[model samples]
Target: MALDEAALETLGLGTMWVRRGAPSGQGVVEDEPALEEPRAAAYETASPAARPAAVQSVEAKPVAREPESQSVSAAPTESAPGDTPVRPVPPETAKTIRIAPAPEPEPLDEPAWDDFEPVPPVGFDPAPASAPAARSADIAALDWEALEARVSNCERCRLCEKRTNTVFGVGDRAGDWMLIGEGPGENEDKQGEPFVGQAGKLLDSMLRALSLARGENVYIANVVKCRPPGNRNPEPDEVAQCEPYLQRQVALVKPKLIIALGRVAAQNLLKTDASISSLRGRVHRYEDVPVIVTYHPAYLLRSLPDKAKAWVDLCLAYDTYRQAIPNDKARS
Candidate 1:
């Protein structure tokens, strides 16, 4: 509670009493002076030197307060035991002032965390498992005669539009040894059979060295039956279209062992993009059949130094082919 003006004056501190003198009687307040002058005058002539002699001579102590209802007003009162003098209120000092009740405190703006419902922790789904691709259904169903017929009359790709002839594979149909090349060349396109002209003769000589012969236990075929224009390597789409025919050929021959005669042949036959250098000198599996990669006769002709390596590849193929044969006792 703030000190009353009379209590402050008793304490020797200046009082900010608004009245010019104490209010004298009921309805008898003095005329208002300028508000600024009254506020300024409230502090005047009230410095340390001007303090009342009675207050300055005595030690200060807290004054005891009466209850609000029994508080003294502006009349002089006798001092009680250990009690300081207090002024009494003027008669019926304007009926006790009543303060209004304070308004209820406004609610806080932010919401409490406890007010919200619990949320579930988030989770993620696992990725789908990868699987090997399924082989072509239509191609798998074709037989020797049906496969050959399909390949011959096939206009399945752009190769068909400019094809001189579809070299629908040659050599032994029931051969145990199969060799595959990339596609037809100039002579093979004209002849309607694979391995003709110089490359064919060289292939024949190589077979003779291995004690094998064309149309004996050996079958010669190609990945693409039709020649690519100017003997450029077959485009990916061309190879895709022609792959079904080659797949059918592999199914029909059921060779004891197969040989891939060039980079393109090895890559397409193996269904891989690995280089010939990485693929050669090993027996790799083409589903059930074992395959060996070798330099193509045309390639060997150009790269004559590799002919010795080709012979080594042929030896590996021969060993692989022999291993595929059952033991004599097992066979018996």
Candidate 2:
């Protein structure tokens, strides 16, 4: 119990006392006089040299006690020995505070894959493969005739009316590396081939640099067959209509590596709108084949500086091709 002022002064210390009582059977208490107040001695001021005496007060208050009865109550009653005190209606101490949960974050709205468009870097070329024979064998098994037939009668979109011929792809059908361009240009539309014209020559030279041939180790195609008048990007509807033909070719030929030659091809095939800089220098998957995206040959023809980057993509494609079909037996 806390020490009263009288008890503290009498003890000359901060000490407190817990009153004790004998058992009910042993001894009974009779009415007694009030406790006498301790005498307070004078006001002796402390000198700088003499410090106040050390006092250690008991920090804890009294523990719970048993109940007791009283004749009359003036102030709040305290428990005597062997009696529990009526717990003072516990002081309304502030209750523990709690913080509410944060509101759920709003969900983001990302564009769908089909809606994305891939844009290739100005300067870059895809790599060539080593095993042209194995690659060609795989492609030969697929029906290019069926693919052409499908494209020939394709009236899936309005472009069918404007198209001269169904530019049904060109180059090595059996090639290990497939070159996919955006769509046909004037020359390609007229010739029913992909990458014909000055750009095609440059592309051929690029293939030759890596010891590749046009109709030998490399195959070329585009996302759309018809030229989008004045060489504009093909419309979504046009690409949507023509895509099945390309998909069938890819499935039949099963090229070990697919080199998306431009933003349009990369965007359409990879289903991503990220720029070529972001897509380059990394390996991507197209169905079961490894795909290395790079700039279009036309773009490379326009910007000579990008040749080095194109070389990098080419090297990457070659490395991936090697990894895909390790040996002759693996192709079987």
Candidate 3:
């Protein structure tokens, strides 16, 4: 029987547990109270706007059974006369439900120290990962002359003060290939062009082996404009500050492929600390362009044994470039 609204409000029970059920068997009679005390109180105290409509309670009672039937676990036998409803004994009297709370999902196995590789530091002075370059999103629409002008006058970091000139990129603005190095070296800083020394000469020869010309078809830039003191690795901060110009240049040039030379360039562009061995010969996407990684020309010079691997990387780059271009346009 459904409880009257007055009886429902008088009890303190909330209506959250209110549900309707049908008879289970022949001897079982379902008794519903006006509302359980807990359910009534819940609804009475609930905000008027949130209260549900028509709350009720349901309980099961067993009628007198056959003499041989001795199941004490069944519902309490019989209901009260008239409007009275039957109530089950408190659950404490009932058997424990044995609800082992899903065994608090075995604490994840702690990774072994050796299994956890160190993360490369995320912050750097001058050029931080926190601040990306500010430039038009579209590279093809950028004004290269204006970009070069800005790079020349850029004082975004202290590197500008240490440099003779901002080794802004030089070569075909419409080039299909882009070369990115760690930053300006002593020779590059002096000449105000990327890759002009022994390493640059090697790079030129490497390009020629693929029939690619430096000033005619390939473009070059560095991660930083100024040389680090004593030719140390350019710190993360330095790259962060100078990357905006490179990002803008890459966007403007829209090269079909980018070759990130050495660890610094690879790490900076990929935001990864993976070893060069792990990175080499693999292709990665830089914006819409395909990026091929190889040993830096300098490193190849130092470790001559790796030059053969560098050649392989170059071949992969050439193949990837060929794949990226339409067959009809591949010759061009």
How far is each candidate from the true structure, as Cα RMSD in Å? 15.6, 17.9, 23.6
lDDT of 1 by residue, 80-188 (tens): 5665433333343458778999999998897788769665457643333211113256667878887778787887689998888899888888898998999999999
Please, what are the lDDT tens digits per residue for candidate 2 over residues 1-332? 11354465466443222334322221222111122111111112333333122111112243332224422232543357677543232213327679999999998898888777776587654445334444444434557785577678777677777778888877777778888889888888888888888999988888887788888977788888777877899888788667767776777666878999988888888888898889998898877678898888889888999999999998988888788877545767
Q: Which candidate should be chosen as best, given lDDT against the real structure?
A: 1
Error of 1 at 65 (Å): 57
Report how far residue 286 has shifted in candidate 2, in Å: 1.1
Candidate 1 Cα deviation (angstroms), residue 237: 1.7
Instruction: Give candidate 1 misplaced runs (Cα > 4 Å).
Output: 1-136, 327-332
Reference-based lDDT, each prediction: 0.75, 0.69, 0.73
TM-score of each candidate structure, all chains considered together: 0.58, 0.55, 0.57
User: Who is ahead in TM-score, 1 or 3?
Assistant: 1
154 Cα displacement, candidate 2 (Å)? 1.3
After superposing candidate 2, which stretches have Cα over 4 Å from the reference? 1-142, 327-332
